[model samples]
Target: MLSSINNIFGNSKKKKTDAIQSAVVAYSIRNGKLTVLNEVPEQSVKNVQAETNGLVLTQGFHKIGGSFFYFEEPGLYFFSFPFQKNSLRIVVGKDAIENALLISNTIIRGNKDDEQSLKHLKKEVLDRFLVLTCTYACIFVQHILNETGIKSRLVMTLTAEEENQYNDGHTLLEVYDTAIKKYVLVDIDKKCVFESDNGEKMDLLSFTGAIKNEAKIRIVSAAGFPKLDWAGFCAVDSGFNFQFIEQMFCYDEQQQLNLYKRICNLPVIMADNKYFSVSSATEVKNSWKNKLNFLPVEEFRQKFYPL
Candidate 1:
């Protein structure tokens, strides 16, 4: 059934007023079956001839030549090869020249149903979607990291969010969380940090401080705004950390301005100010390695280890 459809509408050609031509290569699937339809009209044939004549004449040949006679019609036409059960549709118009050339080539090459062609198309679509998602996520994560003044490598986890909907596949998120000993607490005014294993309190000095030398940290939020939050953090980590702090805290040019500011803002043993920090670096790193065991880390090992 699909073969028949492809035979009928797999290729279409159309002509334009300027004598240029356009062609459509399309196929449809329905009810687990595929069909190809002819979408070209008759007018395209005349256009094809005109274009061919123009090209040939431009080369300084008075006599029109080479497939010039094939553009007699001005609309769509259907044709079937000898011993072929399926019929193909071609629209002839000003656009017919290019369309004709393409259809002719397809006929000669015999690649209409090549496995490589299908695979190429599928890969193109997948690559496009992946690029779009990654770009958006990167920007969003950077922004959040800058605002929070946290420094940590942001790695994504592929975890299923919801079940298949309307037969579509599940949704996933690239995520990272701090180790079990690492804990974080935040308030409206300032982000408080604490360590579960050490019982020590460390205030979040800046976004860069959060992830700079530290191994990892857990991201916590209500269930919504996944893309926005992730993009914010990624933006900061990518480069905007110090710039963000400068905008929020103005200071004169000093060699140790950032460090000075952090120390100045440190919270005393005051009430109503909460603090959040990680428990232990070793425990956090181990937990993350266990959770992300499926990642491609062989390259990481090679880079970190020379021999």
Candidate 2:
């Protein structure tokens, strides 16, 4: 996986050395009142005071770190003088966006075991962590495809009732491969593509079903995180079986292989050898659990426990 990821980015040219630089100042309106976050003294606004709520201009660029633009409706606005000389204008083109996303992935790369931080978190907070994990995964996968020079965007699984009644949805990455001139539907977590979706039996397998189901699905902006109540991750019956236990109970590759082998040797019944007995399921589960250093729900407490 690491080698494959390297091969993807290695193909792309390094970002340009001539980095654009500027300073930004923004004012937002919430609840019909203009407000500035910084507690600037009233006298500081003498030079740039806006007599009305039209637009404001600044004098020159100032030192600002990690340049980016962000705005939201009913609360935030990316305010700057459009025509003024030396004023901040967000220059986030496609290449810039791609670079930012790649940088984020690099930060998250060495921290796969970082789930330890969730230890002792309340169930409310743990739920939030799961939402964040999936959301970040969606963004990471989309950016990874973009960095590889493949055209892709995020998709949401929504039912007719969901569309009619609710405003929630699940995130999925859909990519367009120029070489094949076809679209590929991908679920990054399962690491598979859509094999079939008949509203009853949805198959998420790799490589096969994408070619037959090539259609121009409407894409939406990838902004906010997805919710747990969303269709894909909501219920096991929804056909997107999220393996929460598998993710929470992580194992290294060798440990996983060893567990598989051990379970195979047991007297557990098997369904075509792909399934195991539920009667001894507790024993099998506990065996793997013993290998981990700490419990999932009480990892922090484990540290203080007596030997």
Candidate 3:
């Protein structure tokens, strides 16, 4: 079913309108209707294309986009792939999350320090949310640059601490700030990245370079996958390749509990429907290990848990 949806939605061609391509198109998907808001201040608001079943037809034309649709909407809906160079991605905010919570406290309801909690967390958050980590800490931040009405792409980078072998893997976003004419590094998970020319502060490469002691860099773009590619209760995209993620390691359930409790207070918030398609526990574990070496979940808990 997901494959069929992808087959239809994925069939995109080059659009002739540069205005639509570079414009910040506001979109919303509700009750199977996909609507696009493309209007100039003096111009009347018009829907360029309205597709049934909420599949985005304009993937290649626009590099940046926004959606007002709430993920908590209970129904089957197709999400356009985030693989395009200038594709628009949805933002997961607080209100939408809080609203979902009202419907079901089970969204994020569990103790942060138990293996059961981890399972519930995965079921509620990890499964739906992509867990992005950097070198120091896992922080979730949000920032919207209103500079040009057109949204910009954000690049989320992951660099290994040991060899500094990094995978640019995934477009956290590709933000084009033409007015500033400067590169901006956004912590997508944190949802906040201050726009500044201070190369030293927002410089992820510099920090990794200092640790790796190498000037040369190798990075891979980890583009987020569409809903079809993700493993879920109903559908599965077998062709979807799971990358970088490996088995999650722990001595026992106790350790797992500790780790969960440790990061519960951190800036991480598991939003709705942000689950990963890779539902395998082993895969998640391995991915966690690959990203952050087996520093014993217990160690983190011991370090951060209130004494």
Candidate 4:
């Protein structure tokens, strides 16, 4: 299903247009009514050539580069691939993310700390009355970027004190910046970044390696959080609150950060009919591990929980 969606939304020669719509990728196609993926805007798609099996076509179906068309016939058909990269630069990504965060701020209201809270968090998201949880924040952003062919994921942050019960736990996102061919960690909701000593924006794995080495990291934030509805969700709403975070982390004697969770694409964050396609947990975890390239000190021999 993912592959088929990717192919249909795949990039190819598109006709030039004076204006581009902030529409998302195709979501569901039941009874010939195409539902666009939620919020994940495809602003770059100027035109698309739709067909069936490279041969058959329905009446009013687009045969060439057409921005607007009609699907008059009804039946189930396959789609193309997903995650075809978009070439728009610098500000486009930031603007898209900020816009997404603003929307998330208004909807989801609170942060869901661990598995226990997720039970209720899931219900809140489906209802459109959002709670300010990092998990769902990433879910929203991941799909927004995913629909437009930008790669991203939902990752967890766990504390080394395994018995702490996730008091220090957090969740963040790792977005693949195709321009650099590297994944960068995003504070997601607040539009901030994790950086190393050299002032480079760090990916989750790289930051994990730095944390392993007892190195310091800088959390650079943008201006501020927009005035939104769910201002009460402190944990998520304080994304740019570096002082708050630093004060919280000041107690850590050895490490500046807690153990980072191996990438879990959030296989469980499902929606009946919205945006983002969930992938297998094993698949996302392995992909994250493979990206590690050079292995860190594997102290957790039995199970590699952290780097």
Candidate 5:
């Protein structure tokens, strides 16, 4: 999301740069008064409308930040002014036209203290402003593509090292790929095998028997894993199924072959074969609890006081 926002606003080519740099402003009005607004310099004022009352007012952009007054109705009036030299604008209206003018003058021509007050007012306007403009381009696109929909699914493969090194700072694609390849094979609406990083490999039947007999398996790593390094199988049911395979091979061909053989001998149950790479088991467990939003008290006890 951050990357997408940056991409839309960060390009530096002359044409795209000009388009982004072009000012975008916002505004809103309520209860027969203008309340929230933004003022921009260089670019044109694209559109304006009232959100609550359905009253509409339209105007063009001015190069300088200044004041403009107009009458809307009998005993009612509108006033527009810029907040800063090149920032947003604030529009205010009132039934008492004379009082409104006095306040507007005090704000626009007042002393340094008054200027400070106006700056605060401008900040408030900016903080609360909402977009009142609607473009026909978006409407047209929505209308044309109303019937079509997009669906996608990903099956990732990650390594043990990658699993234990989890960080949201990485791209979604990177994380997805890492999770699928290392721990579980994700598929749509189908039961798939889950692999664990247990010290020794065993067949599925033996693995299930051991897990059923022991009830719990201990995850131990003498070489500490990175913070947030954990792995799990997540199955998403969203009406789409796609499959892709990724293989990892190293320069040491003999070592790679031996590793492959070991993996091939592993158990098949989703729970029995799972392993997490984490710097501290307790911390990782707590983090997962907070993220997943529900931790059984029994699980909590096991996390803090594991036998």
Candidate 6:
């Protein structure tokens, strides 16, 4: 047991080197004003002061960090700056993005886990850590993808909880994989993507469907993390006919694998443009108690887009 934990630690990502790479700075409007998070602070803003080409920043801009000027505004915004060191020749296609997950892989993983209280770090996780908690890695990678013009959403996978156990719900990303022509789930914290035995990538709903139909599915490495190291960490249904999927991205000798396995009827909410914002955090959603509104996805789409 100790050896497995030590092995995972030994296989974790190495620290960063002093090479200049691209930059990603995130902002949210706090107290009716634009404010940059200190964890992903003003200093991380490299060279995005002005508009690039004709992109206009679409929504209103603000000077949260010291990197930009004349951009005073209020309220939260959900937009990502198209990041590139120089002129970015926009790729044209029905799928206008590629290599998003791979590009993010080079930037988001980190060895450090002090994400919440990382107020004092100069620059936190501009690149690499497989050991960071699921939520932290998801949020950072979401921003990086959005910054680079890839569409992604936050997905919370819930499972049945035991009386005294914590680690039931987990957060990961639902990224639009162009090759699949649909969204697929990617677990950056685990350095893996969920897939079926036939080599098709899977989103949460699809994964649940495969499990329901008694099909073979598995997790494959996104980076160089070996498949053998990550095998057998997940136990679906927990030896019953229930629709539960409990996976352990973290190394635990005690076998607390209930991280991000999926099941129907869990009914997770808050997947939208603001999915990455703090205002849409999972804990905040739990505070609504029973008054939260519910809607059918198909019906909701038909009513909203009745064209």
Model 2 clash count equals 0
lDDT score, candidate 2: 0.31
TM-score of 5: 0.16
Per-model TM against the reference: 0.15, 0.24, 0.22, 0.40, 0.16, 0.44
- Predictions in order: lDDT: 0.25, 0.31, 0.28, 0.41, 0.25, 0.42
* Candidate 1 lDDT over residue span 1-307, tens digit each: 9988776564431223123222333332222233443444434434342242111112111112111223223222222222322222233223312222212211111112223332342333221211122223233333333333332222221112222211111111111223322212221111112232245323332222333444333322121111112222222224332333323322322322332223322111111332112222232222232332221223332332223
**Model 6 TM-score?**
0.44
1 versus 4: better lDDT goes to: 4
Ten consecutive residues with minimal summed lDDT in candidate 3? 220-229
Position 25, candidate 4: lDDT: 34
The model with the greatest lDDT is 6
Strongest candidate by TM-score: 6
Q: For residues 1-307, what per-residue lDDT tens digits would candidate 3 score against the true structure?
A: 9988776666543343433455443444433356654433323324433432211122222222333232233222232323322222332222322111111111211112122333243333311332333221121111212211333333333322222122222223333334454333333322323312333222232322232342322221111211111232121234333321211212333442232222221111112423212112332322333332222334433332223
lDDT of each residue in 1-307, candidate 5, tens digit only: 9998777666645566456445343333333354333444324433323232111222333232242222222221223232322333323322222212211221111112222342344343332221110111112112212212211122111121212222111100000122123211211111012234454322223233333344332222111211110121111344221111111222233433333333222111112234222122232322232222223434532442244
* Winner by TM-score between candidate 4 and candidate 3: 4
Model 4 TM-score is 0.40
Model 1 scores a C-alpha lDDT of 0.25
User: Model 3 — TM-score against the truth?
Assistant: 0.22
**Candidate 1 Cα outliers beyond 4 Å, as residue runs:** 1-210, 213-307
Candidate 4 lDDT over 223-246, as tens digits, reads 243322333434444453333433
Mark the regions of model 2 whose C-alpha exceeds 4 Å error after superposition.
Answer: 1-132, 159-168, 196-307
Regions more than 4 Å wrong, model 4: 1-130, 166-168, 223-307
